[model samples]
Target: MVTSIILMNVERSKINEVAQQLADTEGVSEVFSVSGTYDLVAICRVPTNDDLSELVTRGLLTIDAILKTETMLAFKAFSRHDLETMFTIGLDGI
Candidate 1:
């Protein structure tokens, strides 16, 4: 999967509305209203780079309340759960 983390600066009045809209979008997995430089953060996962591009350009950027956005493409994913699972793979047979 192609995962993208999108940081968005939205019009203050429309933050909640925009977040809900983003959450309902097809490729967007989650939307968070955060406290920082950006008002919202959206996690998007798609099948290919072309799908990512279409989601960002056509799906997200089209929102009028979104003042600005920065999209980051994930190269790799690491999680404590995954690591633990990997290390314990053969333990169940013991």
Candidate 2:
């Protein structure tokens, strides 16, 4: 899976509304309201890395309400959930 963290700059009042809309999109996994240089942080899962780029360029940039965004691609993730799924038969370590 090609995952990207999309930092969105949105109007504070419209953060939730924008997040809700992005959450319904096929590639978007999660959207959270945050306080920072960006207003919302959204997680997107695409079939490929190229698709992730297209999504940010074509889709995200096309939205007028969105001011700007900084996308951070995760090289690897160390999570309990991922570890469990990777070891279906159960591993020696928890």
Q: Pick the candidate with the highest TM-score.
A: 1
lDDT of 2 by residue, 14-84 (tens): 77778887888778988998886889899898999889978888877656678889999988878535455
* lDDT (Cα atoms) of all candidates against the true structure: 0.90, 0.82
> Using Cα atoms with residue i matched to residue i, what is each candidate's TM-score against the true structure?
0.83, 0.78
Q: Say which candidate scores most in lDDT.
A: 1
Q: Please list the Cα RMSD from the true structure of every candidate, rounded to 1 decimal place.
A: 5.6, 4.6
> Backbone clash tally for model 1?
0
Which residue pairs clash within candidate 1? none
lDDT of 2 at 25: 75
Worst lDDT run of 10 residues, candidate 1, spans 79-88
